[model samples]
Target: MLTFDIENFPGYPQGIGGPEMMVQLREQAERFGLEVHDKNVEKVDVSNRPFSKSGLKEKNISLRP
Candidate 1:
């Protein structure tokens, strides 16, 4: 587990803890309609795939979009 001090973050006069800071950041992102998909990306193959109206073809971009 990685950890760090968040003394410079806003709304934490006494300096928020590392985990607490992460939670706060997540909440803020959610509030702003940011999609957060927690998953591990394995591979990506952009060849001979279908393309949308923009003509962008991607075979297998193994990410959470």
Candidate 2:
């Protein structure tokens, strides 16, 4: 699994929407033979060392400290 911690630039400051930025990122990733998963995170569990996040599409991702 690959994750990108991109900077979120709000509004059209540079003539790009938030979703459009994600789309561009996905496209760029695909150009490099990377598979992108379009998932919107709905829940996050950061109470412990190993954090877990779940997406609205039923994807459960984990992060270890």
Candidate 3:
């Protein structure tokens, strides 16, 4: 699972933000047969074994066996 903590800190020449970068990265990952989530992550809980992650517009998944 790839979690991106993107922030617009004035590096891009065009009008792009963190969200846009995330989309580009997801597309690249998909080319490599990786499953990309459609919704953006809102919160994450990694304190426990089954690391919990919540999405902004959909149910999240627990990375565990």
Q: What 10-residue stretch in candidate 3 is worst by lDDT? A: 1-10
Per residue, candidate 1 scores C-alpha lDDT tens digits across 1-65 of 15677677578888877987788889998998876656444444445354211213423333222
| Clash pairs (backbone) in predicted model 1 | none
Q: Please, what is the TM-score per model?
A: 0.52, 0.36, 0.39
Evaluate model 3: give its TM-score.
0.39
lDDT of 3 at 22: 72
Return the top candidate by lDDT.
3
- For model 2, where is the 10-residue window of minimal lDDT? 1-10
- 1-55 in candidate 2: lDDT tens per residue? 1333434555545455556677777888789877555578788899986899888
How many clashes show up per model? 0, 0, 0
The positional error of residue 24 in candidate 1, measured at the CA in angstroms, is 0.6
Question: Which residue pairs clash within candidate 2?
Answer: none
Residue 25 lDDT, candidate 3, scale 0-100: 68
Leading candidate by TM-score? 1
Q: Rank by TM-score, descending?
A: 1, 3, 2
Q: Is candidate 1 or candidate 3 better by TM-score?
A: 1
RMSD of each: 8.1, 8.5, 7.6
lDDT of each: 0.59, 0.68, 0.69
